[model samples]
Target: MSENRKKNSALKVILIIILVVGLAVAWIGYRAFIASSIATSEEYFYVHTDEPYESVIKRIEDEGIVKNPSYFNYVARAMDLQTGIKPGRYKLSKDLSNRRFIGNLRGGYQEAVPFRFQNLRLKENFAGALGKNFEADSTTFLNLLNNEALAEKYGFNKDNFFLMFIPNTYEIYWNTKPEEIIDRFSKEYAKFWNADRKAKAAALNMTPEEVSVLASIVKGEALHVDEMPEIAGLYINRLKRGMLLQADPTVIFANNDFTIRRVLNRHLTIDNPYNTYRYKGLPPGPIMMPSIASIDAVLNYNQHEYIYMCAKDDFSGYHNFAKTVAEHQVNARKFQQALDARNIKK
Candidate 1:
């Protein structure tokens, strides 16, 4: 009976050893396989639209975020992440476990990218800027902007479609669609035209579009914000008197050649309706996307009698204003002599 008891005690010791070994192995496996799988230096990972699971894995691997790609693959399969892939920009941090990483992606938890633009000159440029931030391609964006049916839905046409996009920062997802961007901008445009602004437009006898058009001209003419109201007043005076605007910026725009620094008589003769020297009213559309300051400058223009302006001879980016032709001629001669001295023939 004593010998039998000794053998049973020996078996108990062996069983305890096996149990301890099993627990240790299990702990090590859990740490290696499930925990600390992500080892990235970056703060975020971007998964693009229509990206396959393999491409996602490749991107993670290329970014050197996953410590073991095969193990990560196994974990991903076990979690069934392949069947539930969501595209977006995901934030990352060091020491992220495989389970948490997959969970964030599967849950569609993403960060919104901030989008901003100002002083963009053309629709193509605006399209390109939007494409860079969102999932839509530039060609697709341009197509939507030019679509008459779509533009009409937003109360715009191909010529004035760009007016909807005010220069401001917007918080949006990286994968947002082109139509979605347009919709947001359309709402923003409506919000900008409040009752106070509409009343101001009415007081000026101008539509919002016409105000934007004149603002574009004001933007092109002035380099100083302090002078914008004065310039706007000068244009308004000309319009009130039924006089030709004779804005050199319009002539440059008519030629579609922004390189022309000197607005020669030949440039003024451009047959396009954008030429203020030849046309009687505001252009059919804005020549460039004007700033809010420029727009407000037109709305609350300074009450002035000046009808003519000449660029300062010192090239200070400020203009000389005149209430009569004689004063304008004096300013003009000063500028002309300065231009001649510099030999600016163009």
Candidate 2:
């Protein structure tokens, strides 16, 4: 009987050891599964394209994005983070769990980035802004813009290429290729010129691109949003009358001088085709990107007999419209006198 008791006691000891080991492992597995892996101060984590998986792990550690790097590594191994390295900008919270974080990285779950270019003045500036919002280098996009074949592929020349853009933002992946972005914009541009907008452009005896060019002038000249249609109407009237646009904004654009508080006679003397005061009809292309409102204003311009416009002497950002050169000259002289009174000579 004593021998039996000793054997049973030994068996119980082995059982207790096994139970303790199992519990310890369960605690570790639970901790690894539920632990807060992302302790990052940043709202998003970036992984670059073609980056090695090991380098990504190191970046997570170096950036202090994980609470415990070892726990994250163990979970990553379970979720196969090393096998697939998806490059993207992922939205991460401060307290992301190891399981969820690893799953996001492994499954290529990324947040779409927004890029609005409505207000960018120059193509170079637009390309630079794109670089800031995406992974591709700024020059990559600029090169595509400057490429003649690529521009022709989209049915535009370098001069009229700016018309392809809608100036509104769409969902873009952070790591999208430059060529892919241009294609996407081209598709969006096609969609934007639907039958309705096309009919409007046709009714005005203008193509979509021509309307965009005139809209850019309207956008540049009108300071207030309410005055956009009026300005567009005035330009359209001039186009119908076969008169020189004589837009001061075009003169400034031709001279590449934005600091010119006033367009001078010397400014209008530039030989560039963009100088509307010297050239007839539209310039080579749009001087700046026109917003949707500005574009629509040109499509739905106010019809009136007014052939000229001058800024109000009251400095209220409103324009005084006139039907004849005599009335226009009077308005222009008042505005010139107002500028002299304020000493706004450039």
Candidate 3:
């Protein structure tokens, strides 16, 4: 009887051990299955850091990027990723298992916003626009560019730090540091000024910054590329002959109005140093953001002795190049007549 009782106790202990082992295996298998399912889904997810984290997670869940907030929280905690999530724009697969999705978000590899330079008017304006998109301070951007030491380190001379930038679209990692962005742009601008361009600028007795400054002026003067060279020649000739460029754009820029149909003598009397009609030589810096065509025109300006020019008065986007003051006045009169005929005041 004692042996039978002992045998029964041993069997019962064994059974209990097997049952516990089986339950443990099942739980492990279930956890593994959940993790695997989360990793291979096709769900989409996005995060915009403009809002609070809770709101961001809510949006992520609403967009079906994650299966459940609790699952995301659990995975995030388990992987020690709770502190690694970066704030910015992010995109993820909606069908991604909670584990994979949370891991990716924590890794900060989900998305990057693109920075583009379309419809950029001025350096400050472009900086302001970029600030709006990237949550950067525009004042900081402008200050960095205007920093004399920084500008010089980036190959910009004292005379033309304001116009050293070359406008183009750029892809920046989201939430990029402001100083880093400026430094990157400065490096890219240096790259654009290749050895060949540098030599060409040297041959013209100009620095790259000066060339860009003149290019900006040419950019503001004409919208047509075919006329850039002639306009460039005109300005070059004026510089050589010690004549005031007498450019209307400079006067308009000084007055902060390019909409006037005509430039008056009083407009030329504006006390700003940018008024080429009053100030000899080019303005202190570029008045506008020049296109690549204008920059090239400055590098490849035609060798001409022409000192003056006026619009052809045909609205054909052409110019009448002049060699003397008298000829310039005649062309100006013709342009004025054309403007009068069109009832365009300038």
Candidate 4:
């Protein structure tokens, strides 16, 4: 009976050893799984449209954010992530588990890209800037801007469709469609033209487009915001008197040569309708994308009898205004002498 007790005791020792070993192995396995299942780096992973599971796996491997790509692939397959792939920009962190990463991918949680633009000179430049901020390319954006049908559907034509985009920062998804961008701008434009602004436009006897056109000219003329109101007033005076605007900026625009430092009699002879000296009234479209301040300057123009302006001889970006041609010529002569001293003849 003592021998039998000894054997049973030995068997119990063997069982304990096996149990301890099993626990140790289980612990080690759990640690390895946990270590490999979480993102090892903080970065973003983008999944584009029509990308397959293999492509996504390759991209993650290329990014080197996952601790173990093979293990991540196993976990992704086990969770059936392949069947629920979503397209968007996904931000990953070191603490994010493989399960959570896959969940985020399947849920379509994306980061919004911030897009801001101001003082853009041309539609092409605007398109290029917008393309840099979003997934769409410049050509695609330009095509949409030039699409007559699309522009007409949004209550604008290709020539004036650019007026819809207000200069501001907007939070939009990176994958936002071009049409959606235009629609957003249209909505913002409508909101901007509220009752007060509409009343101000009416008081000036100008439509929103006309105001924008004049504002563009004002923006081109005055570098200082404080000077915009006076310049706008001077232009308004010319309009009221049925006199040719003869704005040098309009002549430069008509020539399509922004490099011209001085507008000469030759530049004034340009046959374009934008040539205010050759053709009276506002231009057919804005010369550049006008700022909100310039637009408001036109809406709240200063009352004055001045009908002519010449750039100040001081090179201070301010203009000298006059009601009579003699006074304008005097101001013009001062500016001309300054230009000649600076050797700026074009």
Candidate 5:
């Protein structure tokens, strides 16, 4: 009986050790599963140029894409990945291991797509267009360009600073902030305005603002690039002679509608700062987004004594230069005849 009791006691001790070991192993496995789940969860992530660690964590949490935001923050900080995450939209899974998550975040696993801008003009319009391609509010994007502080820094007044933003195709990451994009474009604009252009503008008694305004008018008026210098020359002559620019583009701008078949005599009487016909100078601002060709045309326009030009009837994509009102009237009549004959629906 004593031998049987001792054997029973030995068996009890062995069973207790096995049970403890099994519980410990199970606990470790469960912990590992939780950690892996948090790492791989389907969460939206983002990073920016100067995003703080707390903000990044909170942003991900607020997005409701993660199951455990704190876990992600802790793991990321532990692995020294607090600042390594790139700026872009990321797709994450809930079942990702911590190692895999960090690897993907820091390893540049995703190729960022690019967004572009082309021929943008109005501040609000530009903002709305950019908003369609990026993750920013349109109003905020516009207010920056219209900001007085940035304008003063860029050597332009509020009314004319918008022209400094040239309309060109710019490549940026798809998720780029509106502010960064604006900064990049503004920097490029500053580079474009060199000392030589500045000297030329000063010589013409025109500010950079006036040059850009004229360039935009020339861009919108002449369909052919070769005609730009001639158009510029005509406007420059008018400015020199104290004559009304009387540019039809200005009338179109004042009207806020560009599809006019022909400018009626009454359209010239519109009371707007942009109507060069009424205002004896250049428009208040640029009428359209001018290209580099147009800007160069204004900068290098040939000095001419002539004060008028009318479209040639030859359909040769050139204009008839007139030195007198009589000659200009004749050329204008000729152009009208050609339009009538071609049944050109303007």
Candidate 6:
């Protein structure tokens, strides 16, 4: 009975030891694989190209991307996460498991940023916008824009290169090269010029780029979307008649002083090609990023005899149209008088 009692005591001790060991193993497994690895609610992190695995791990730890980075390191090694890691922008959430976090990093599960642009007036402005949203440098974008070889390769000259960027939201990898971004824009530009749009441009006896330039003028002239077609027609008439565009917006752009409320005589005399008042027909390129509506308005221009327009005297953001110079002068006088009354000196 004594020996049996001793045997039962030994068995109990062994069973207790096993139970404690199993629980410890379970706890370790949970911490290493099942527990939430991300400390924050959310985080966006970047792994640079050719970055060492040690550096990547350090970034995760230093950036507070994980609740228990040591546990992450353990699971990461177990899954061989370092073997296939690639550079990208990745998102981490508290909901992510250690395994998932490591697995995602290994498989290059990345997030694409939405790049949006519209109504940007200058190439430099667009460069800043690109720099704000991507890993690309502003200087790189500017250099590409100024490169004649690049522009020619893309069916554009340096002057008209800005027209290639049709303003809209585009999903792109954050690490996309600046040149690759230009490629994406070229593709989007092609897509925007469908057969129907090309046919319309052809019927108007203008290239797509020319239409966009005219659209920019139409955009600048009217404050209302409804007025674009009529204003476009008036400009079309001037073009057909081989008259100078004499656009106030072009003069403002050439002067590079957007604060001018009233275009004065001095502003029109700037020896710049963009000064439409000094040059015949359209400017070299768009003075602003033309909206889709403005482009379509030019394509479907209103058939009218009016070749002149001036802002209405009431400042209603509409225009008074006229065919004869005498009538235009009368409209211009009323608008000029209104400007004088408002004290909008430029």
* Clashing residue pairs, backbone N/CA/C < 3 A, model 4: none
Identify the candidate with maximal TM-score.
2
Give the per-residue lDDT digits (tens) of candidate 4, residues 168-284: 888888778877988888898999889999899999889898898899999899899999999999999989999998888878878889899988888887799889987989888
Q: Which residue window of length 10 is worst by lDDT in model 1?
A: 27-36
Go through the candidates in order and give each one's C-alpha lDDT. Answer: 0.87, 0.89, 0.73, 0.85, 0.75, 0.89
**CA error at residue 305 for candidate 1, angstroms:** 1.0
lDDT of 2 at 16: 100
lDDT of 3 by residue, 26-128 (tens): 7654553354333324433445454555676666556554444565655556776545666655554434455665666677775555676633455678668
Candidate 6 achieves a global lDDT of 0.89
- lDDT for 51 in candidate 2 is 92
Model 2: residue 183 alpha-carbon error in angstroms:
0.5
Where does candidate 5 have its weakest 10-residue lDDT segment?
A: 32-41
**TM-scores across all candidates?**
0.89, 0.94, 0.77, 0.87, 0.67, 0.93
Please, what are the lDDT tens digits per residue for candidate 6 over residues 163-279? 888889999998888889999999999999999999999998999999999999898887999999999999999999999988899999999999999999988889999998889
Q: What is the C-alpha lDDT profile of model 5 across 1-346, one tens digit per residue? A: 9999999999999999899999987765444334554533444455655667667667766866445655556566777777687556555665665556666667655435455554665667777877776667788777887888877776776777778777666666656776777778778887888899889888889987789899988887787888898789889989988999988888988988768756778788899998988899887778877778888888889878778887689887688889999999999999888888988755
Among all windows of ten consecutive residues in candidate 3, which has the lowest summed lDDT?
Answer: 36-45
Model 2 agreement with the true structure over 234-323: per-residue lDDT tens digits: 999999999999998899989999899888888889999999988999998999988899999999889888889999999998999999
Q: Distance from true position, residue 124, model 1, in Å?
A: 1.2
| Stretch of 10 with least lDDT, candidate 6 | 36-45
Total clashing pairs in model 3: 12
Candidate 4 has a TM-score of 0.87
How many angstroms is residue 96 displaced in model 3 relative to the true structure, after the best TM-score fit? 5.7
